[model samples]
Target: MADRPTGDTSLPPRAAEFLELRPLLFAIAYRVLGRVTEAEDVVQDTWLHYQDVTERPRSPKAYLSTVVTRLSINVLSSARVRREEYIGEWFPEPLLEDPYQEPERAAELADSVSTAALVLMERLSPLERAAFVLREVFGFDYAAIADTLGRSQSACRQLVVRARRHMARGRARFAADRRAQQELAARFFAAIADGDVDQLRDLLAADVQLVTDTGGNAPAPPRPIVGVENTVRVLASVLPELGRVGLRLEPQPINGEPGALARDREGNLVQAITLETGEGRIRTIRSVSNPDKLTHLGPVADPWQLARDYRESRRRQR
Candidate 1:
């Protein structure tokens, strides 16, 4: 009789190493793919590739890094094809909350995952994006990045430099004072909840736009709501009825900016809201309610502490 298939429980030592690196691998993949579901899929495919190799790698970090980089590169290459067919404007998948809030660390995480940065990255060639992210975001040295990309260190350096210049050209340099922004966001939410259209109008910038992502799965406004008056009127009309649906709103941080966490009466996290500020007025109001996008913001934690831990980890990794 054929030998019985060994369960994961009977896997060898390398399996344990793979398990240990899974979280880090997933993080890398998510940053590259911008979607949690796609990132998870890439990591699983990496694991399968690892399983197929009979020879064990001397350095699991190097092995896993190679697997993730190649997978990310492959995804990036294919993504361009699909993005061309995407409807309307394309934006990066927003992070619901900053998991690491130590100022420097949070900033680093924010820099890597921010909507602005991600959108800018879309303009780069896949190799350039990978090189820049690996070197700048993750602080991988030229030699390591070269090895991962099968290029010379000098070539990797040039790719990163080009990517940085491209990003600098496309990105807006706006610094957010979290406390002040949070206070404003709270007021914005309160205005909506109370049907204070005048307050909402005063708080919103004249050109303000509100984008809601329901993932084409739920009942959401058909098009993006634009202009302060239109946004306020639509929200004022809808929010009062949210109480009847058992949704509650709580203040939360989104992408290191002031935002809100919406939950059901049962206290399950349902959505994350972020406001963009310009010239002391809200320029944009973005609500991410697709359950898939809100997974990162489910249980809120202190942004400061999260930032601290993320910085420490990056320091140690370097």
Candidate 2:
């Protein structure tokens, strides 16, 4: 038996064991589900079950991972329904910074949790997503992955192969250079804040696409805006309003990519924007203005209020 708690929430032996592996379990769940809240829930639930076990497992790491992955699979099953009803284009919740402890697998880990990768994973079934994350990203062997998913080793291998085929087109092609990403992001946001259309256009890919998620709670384009010209026009028009409301831009690492967090005059987060760059030009931009998503990041202001204020200010100017 584990030690009793002095308080109601004191750590038990199994709970302590699970807590030690919390980072790894979180990485697995987040990779599988792409939502922080859901991922955290899965980890917590795994700990709850871990406490009930009368027999100790030979390897707690594998046991906890299995529990987390299965729980995430269950969540993902229902999450897909909500996603289908989601307003506008839905994106994975941005991981503001790396939270896991495996520095050696940093590159691999980043690719697994990247905005593009998560979006691509949405096309895969929950089981395939689990198999891919376990086998490819976390380096789990076929037999272990099979046990985790309650499938045969051969079947798990097939799931990984199928997932790879589905993701081949969208898989990452660039090496992550944190310094380069930060420098480019700095220049990119500076151009936006300064309203330098030409500079912004220069930093963008010829066929860049911008996707914004406001969940119909705030004003945003109803669909993805594609093409360099369209994206530049849209950014030029919206960013000024953002700036007008005294929303400041700060560079931060989001989902392993250099990105910007937008805050209002009072320092409340209004939006988070992440860019994908290649050949020194931005190819993709994802922004989340959904208040529900921003709550976990920090205190968030109403995005629509800012837009409304921008309109009123512009009217007064006229």
Q: Which candidate's lDDT is highest?
A: 2
Q: What's the distance in Å from true for residue 228, model 2?
A: 2.1
* Per-residue lDDT of 108 in model 1: 77
Clashing pairs in 2: none
Q: In candidate 2, what residue range of length 10 has the lowest lDDT sum?
A: 1-10
Off by over 4 Å in 1: 1-16, 92-104, 214-223, 242-247, 261-272, 278-280, 289-318
Per-residue lDDT of model 1, residues 15-121, tens digit only:
77777677667667766777766777787888888877889988888888778988988997898887776544455555654332445565676657765567678
What is candidate 1's TM-score against the reference? 0.74
Angstrom error of the Cα, residue 72, model 2: value is 0.5
Candidate 2 ranges with C-alpha deviation above 4 Å: 1-12, 172-176
Q: Return the TM-score for each candidate structure.
A: 0.74, 0.93
Residue 80 lDDT in model 1?
86
Write the residue-wise lDDT of candidate 2 on 1-318 in tens digits: 433223335666666676678889999999999899889888778877887888999999998999999999999999999999988877888788656768797887887888888999999999999999998998999888989999999999999999999999776576667677778888998898789999999999898999898888777888889998999998898778767778888888889887889899999998888899887888899999889888888799888888888888778778
Backbone clashes for every candidate come to: 7, 0
